[model samples]
Target: MTAPPDRRIAAHRPDLADRRLEGLVAAGQFVEGERWRIALASVPLRAAPRPDLPFETEALRGEVVRVFEETIEGWAWGQIETDGYVGYFSADALGPLAPEPTHRVIVPRTFLYPAPDLRRPPREALSLGATLALGEAVETRGTLYRMTADGAAAVVDRHVAPLDAPHADDWVAVAEGFLGAPYLWGGRTSLGLDCSALVQLSLAACGIAAPRDSDLQESAVGRPAEGPPRRGDLVFWPGHVGLVAADETLLHASGFQMQVVREPLAGAIARIGAPRSIRRL
Candidate 1:
């Protein structure tokens, strides 16, 4: 029988091992090129080049990726630089490589305005952690404007932070802000985020490196916390995780609640079952 259609395509790009391509590359018959940058707000990285298929991850705007192949149907097979994730992305979501980012959005989402005028419509909305090239800063009528990549500009309020800003000391506060955000299986942005994505993004904002999925996160980050759970600790189940808000509380993006929420740890354990492990970072 034929092998099942490869679901691991998004995790491991086996297509890179095509016999013909491998032969050509081994014989020094391939070309090299620079990586491309994502231009759209966010693009899904799917196992295959189809919208109906499931997506494994998302490439945020301004993220760079190295393309391995481009199909006639307008999809590009590539590796995302931020997380080394491999999958197929829409070619239309990319642009020529640009300079490194100078700033990162701090708010859940903010609008990119075409001009400084408030009455004018926005060019687009940028999600938290979305990076952009910096340009001149201008202030008009008591409002400050910061020019962004592609000549777009956003009001330079407290919504955006310098790329080099210090890591947050209280990560719990950061995760708590998404208390009402909708749940999306593969989403990482504030627009819609899943449990693991919420944990990853919140920790990332605090300058902690995190993997995309819960199991990898449980393996890669932090050390085990001894005794009773403490604030800033992490709790893990089979495929899920929650952040400790206090000795008896957990803060997490719950698929069951369909949003982020704070709950009593014992109650969560009863509903989601006992945790496999607890850790501290």
Candidate 2:
């Protein structure tokens, strides 16, 4: 038998084992009433898995938040309080993280199955965590979300948690509603999604059609404008992108330093970031 190729976050960070103090960092508020947190140790995914697409990494010694709904074990996207670099992690093998409302974390284990009706008794199968929203939303009916090893994923009767980030949830809702997920690289489903795909999908939810990918996103979304950005605007970086951060910052799951992050518009503009754009959709 052939051995599976080593596709791990360490591939992105060859120096992940080293415990080092890099610099002063802090988490930014996405929602208006969000509480902030100061990371002590690295809170990486127990395993490495893709959130939207394959990830790339660089050398670093710090922590990361594994997006279970988006990635696999042994894989994680590296993240600092500031930069969200793309990388991997050993799922369920990192320090403990305080899963709070302000900070939405996916369950590392889940399951999915094709069921005709959610009201029907669930099959004698358990799905581990894989996909995570603020909480899973109930689908129309007779839909299989997916499966892992613990819980089952179904669009049926699931309920969404009280999301503090209304805008964020709204983005998710609008995106999922349009896409109806589980979409592949080009697959459009309310269950699956990608980064740019999410953007385009969200816009579509709001009745705005956009082309796929970053370059296309700039052209299809809102037009070029000079000045501080506001809510519902899309922020773009070179080969990367994110949503506006409350008129002053930009929030995104940047592949640069993987993980959902926020940064100031000026700070983003001054850097090697791309032409920041906005989408009124």
Candidate 3:
């Protein structure tokens, strides 16, 4: 018999499943979900349809989700296209799919403005790795801003890089930039994030794709390494993961400290136990 699907990434439930899984899984009904785009800066993707449910992850602006079901209570059951994470997203956070994104946010976070002028009150802050479909450029007060494809907002040009731009040479430095960011349970933004999210977001800025959870990342991110950990090496424990910052320092979003921090490898091992594996990119 085939193994059961991992529910975190599988678009399946007892009552409904993705049309592609019709033969492999049992469900009350199968549907070919419609594509939708995240319209807000960020929105929680919860495991259940209730507001009280802790988020499983977060969907960032411009990401696409395949929505299979919608409820009158403002929940939309869907799977994220980028990470294949399955969850219930707030219906209001989604909109009709827009034009393909041409650029991606390269900074930790940036403000979206209502006009090209930076002096105007900002609209929202977009997190790193958020994709944007940009139109023409406009300069005001010596600042260059790129207008959204629909002309709904503007973003500082330097804050985003073209989709085809070369990746960062030092992704670890990218991760280090988040030092002191709050450790949120299931967040994936610069405002707040979890351990796996720290890895995922940092790698994404360097043009690498990663799984959404620590266990999945531990298995899929890179090849195994067997020596002293070096910068950028991924260190994993049973339910957690971190990156080697230096010879003996580990950089991670620590739940213990409620923030991203750099701690000695020996101290981390003492607190969390020996690492299960270490992998190098």
Please, what is the TM-score per model?
A: 0.87, 0.36, 0.98
How much lDDT does each candidate structure score?
0.78, 0.38, 0.93
lDDT of 1 at 109: 79
For candidate 2, give the lDDT of residue 256. 42
* RMSD of each candidate relative to the true structure: 4.2, 17.1, 1.0
What residue pairs clash in candidate 1, if any at all? none
Which candidate leads in TM-score? 3
Question: How much lDDT does candidate 3 score?
Answer: 0.93
lDDT of 3 by residue, 19-79 (tens): 9888889999999999999989999999998888887999999899999999998899999
User: Candidate 1 lDDT, tens digit per residue, 96-165?
Assistant: 7757788887777777788866667987777777788877777778877787655666656567778888
How much is 184 displaced in model 2, in angstroms?
A: 12
- Better model by TM-score, 1 or 2? 1
Residue 208's lDDT in candidate 2:
55
Tens digits of per-residue lDDT for model 2 on 1-281? 54322333111223223122122211221111111222321222222454544323221111234332213344434332222322344334343333422212122112223443545554332111111222333344445332211234332223211234232335533432322223233222223334565575455334455655666677657776556566767777656555664657765544443333466767766765456455544
Candidate 2 local Cα displacement, residue 113, angstroms: 4.2
